[model samples]
Target: LFICIDHVGLAVPDLDEAVKFHTEVLGWRELHREVNEEQGVAEAMMGTGDQLAENARIQLIAPLNEDSTIAKFLAKNGQGIQQMAYRVADLDHVSAVLRERGMRLLYPEARRGTSGSRINFVHPKDARGVLLELVELPKEAEEH
Candidate 1:
């Protein structure tokens, strides 16, 4: 159903500060960064050693506005671990299987995610109170 743990997402009040702390203090290297307006968040993918390795990711996500989900999560739980992402070979297939198994996904269809990956979320309520993100990397990236 899943390849590996893709990344662990951390909700932060400030993206720059989070990235700086992770990079400078934690000795992580910044791998990728992007802003997804539709998701209303700014994110950075941090890593060490081989950037593309499955074990090398820690995503830092910051709300773009007060209305963003990250903002709401921060308001309720404070800045912390927001989600655990799993890599999938086929998002649509995995989504269908999870649906058949009675897991509720947040999106009816896969949505655009960091680094051109197709992604969807398993509802926190259905995922044992943990937000779970499913990601299918782009074809070119799959070979890496």
Candidate 2:
């Protein structure tokens, strides 16, 4: 089951510039930053209010390699929103149900995500043209 929107992912041509704009222009504070070699992305999470709160942030994703998915997205669509991530209470169960209902998952198996969560994406075509990411945070990270 879905809990709430975790963050909206924006594919950016340059991570530093994006982060600067969000922080200086929009007044959002950078909460976290990481480079995932496997995913071929360098991302920074920006939040306006409480950094620890769920659904209060945006993730700026920049390609770490030219051949990465973000790079392809930028080439096709330019820098913009790439995906909407939703936090789920039970990722495995949700994934199973989606499969049973004939939905296409980008990563069929759950993979490590930012903040140590298990995550997978529902293909854009299967999700009505919106790339949707499903994230299941660790028990301790859940909002009370």
Candidate 3:
């Protein structure tokens, strides 16, 4: 079953600049930054507050190549909400249900995601016009 909102992604022009702006100027902690070539994006994760508390995350996304979706998104709509991620128990099962409903997926199947989790994206058209991401964390990652 679907669980929780993992984090909201924001498309940015530059990952480094956004990281600097959030950390130096706003005083947030840089939790992690990594490039997922398969996704064609460079991502930066910023922690707004302690994890023990109700803290949100700032995810800055920048295109790694000109052909990237984020690149096209910036060219068309400018920097803004990229996608919303939702945690899930079994992505495979959800995929079957979505397929049975004729919903389209951005990825053919789930793939390794940031922080070593598994993720898949549903098309905006099928997700009520909001790009939705389904994520399943690795067992080891979840144990922590």
lDDT of 2 by residue, 1-144 (tens): 787899999999999999999999989889889998878999998987763673388999999999999999999999999999998988999999998898898885899999788999898999999999999987777654
Worst 10 residues of 3 by lDDT: 49-58
Q: Which predicted model would earn the best TM-score? A: 1
Q: How accurate locally, in lDDT, is each candidate?
A: 0.94, 0.90, 0.85
Candidate 1 lDDT tens digits, 1-144 = 989999999999999999999988999988889999989999999987664864479999999999999999999999999999999999999999999999999999999999999999999999999999999999998677
- The best-first sequence of candidates by TM-score reads 1, 2, 3
Could you give candidate 3's per-residue lDDT for residues 1-144 as a string of tens digits?
A: 687787789999999898898889999788888999988999987777666135577678999999999999999999989899887878889877887899898878799888888999889999898998888877775644
Ranked by TM-score, the better of candidates 2 and 3 is: 2
Candidate 3: segments with Cα more than 4 A from true spot? 50-55
Tell me the deviation in Å of residue 31 in model 2: 0.5
Displacement of the residue 51 alpha carbon in candidate 1, Å: 3.7
Tell me the TM-score of model 2.
0.94
Q: Score residue 122 of candidate 1 by CA lDDT.
A: 98
